[model samples]
Target: MGLSVENSVTQSHTRTHKTFLITNYMLLGAASACIFLTLSLRLLPSLCGFFLILLHVVTIASAVSGCSIVTSGSNKSYAAHMVAMVLTSIFQGSVSVLILTRTSDFLGYLKSYVREEEGETILKLAGGLCVAVFCLEWVVLGLAFVLRYYAFVEGQSAHPRNERVSEEELKNWPWPFQV
Candidate 1:
């Protein structure tokens, strides 16, 4: 009886914590997405550029809540993840190509910051570094989404449980939450 009560309490606490964590992730993702979109649109201010930036927002959304990507409320979703990756990659690729096409103008814009030759070199280096970092972040976000989707499809999901898991299952649960 004591064990049953403890399990019930633990399950409830776990459910509440899961909800809170997910909510925090979603809120932060939405806020950061707004910042990213605003900066991209303001800096580039072109139709294709806007869409490319919007894809970045979608990528963040996927990381925050891949489960929410479902259209029909189903958990099985490897195909959805594939679609997301393809679409995001297309936009990222297009943005890179577009940057290439604007090489002269981009350089001019960079040089505008500081008119010295050294300034131009610095600008080029900084811009390249920023792009590389952004691409790395995008890759990480994609990997996280893929991992989350895989867990969902395999029923190894991060769902908030209404009922207590068996002791065997509890053994597999993450540490600090082990019952």
Candidate 2:
């Protein structure tokens, strides 16, 4: 029975790991697509264009870093990953709303060389993708938290509760710190 329970836990962990990888890959592709769509508007040379592309670049970077966060033992790395994901998700959502609601004004700001109608269409498509990226970022954040929980559980299990610290070992501690 114990063996079966361990096997089930391993299977659950494997499934979660796979889902995490798949979501990150989808996020990368969506972010890349948004960059291409932005370029299609011929806004690459403008300041607004530069920042738009930079935002997607940062999203891609965060997603890439997320893949390794599970194996990294440092608390700092986990905290940084959480911060990046939250910021990117917020920015992506705001951009999508702006693109969808104020298409013409946004195009004027971007100084896009494309015709008004074409630019609006492209912006809408990119906005839709931004929404996807935003949702995926949050999903990835949740999965990362779950993975960390699993790691903590496994680590605790490794040190059996049946083993007690000997009194002699306990007495060797620094004076005030002794339990």
Candidate 3:
């Protein structure tokens, strides 16, 4: 019975890990697409354009780092991943909303070399990709949390530290703290 339970847990963990990986991959693709769309606007000389591209690059880096950190299984790595994902998710959502709602104004700010209509079209496409990236970032964050929890549980079960305390060891504790 115990073996079966352990096996089931392992299977579940495996499935969750796979899902986490797939979501991160999707995020990478979406970010890349956003970069390409931004490039299509031919606004690389503009500060706004540079920052937009930088944002997508950061998103891609976060996703890549997330994939690498899974194997390290360190609390610090998990915290970093969570922080990166949250920030990127927020930024991506904001960018998408801005592009979708104020396409003309944003294009003017970008100083895109393309014609107005074409620039708007590209911005909308990038905005759609940003939305996809935003959603995928959150999903990745959730999956990372789940994977961390599973790792913690498995670690505890595999090498439990809750051994029975000896009588002498227990007696050394302060009265109120005695187990």
Best by lDDT: 2
Question: How many clashes (backbone atoms < 3 Å, residues ≥3 apart in a chain or on different chains) does model 2 have?
Answer: 0
> What would the TM-score be for candidate 1 when compared with the true structure?
0.37
Per-residue lDDT of 1-179 in model 1, one digit per residue for the tens?
A: 98897678567545544553454365345435434533532445455435544665665655445444432234446456546645654554554454445544654542233344544453344334335434544554455444445445435434665766789998888898884
lDDT value, candidate 1, whole model = 0.49
TM-score of each: 0.37, 0.90, 0.89
Q: List the residue pairs that clash in candidate 3.
A: none
lDDT of 2 by residue, 25-60 (tens): 999999999999999999977898899999999999
Q: Runs in model 1 with CA error above 4 Å? A: 1-45, 67-76, 105-179
Better of 2 and 3 by TM-score: 2
Top TM-score hit: 2
Candidate order (TM-score) = 2, 3, 1
> What is the C-alpha lDDT profile of model 3 across 59-141, one tens digit per residue?
99989999868646477877887898899889999999999999999999999989999899999999999999999998998
Shift in Å, residue 3, candidate 2 = 0.9
Error of 3 at 111 (Å): 0.5
Q: Please give the clash total of every predicted structure, in order.
A: 0, 0, 0
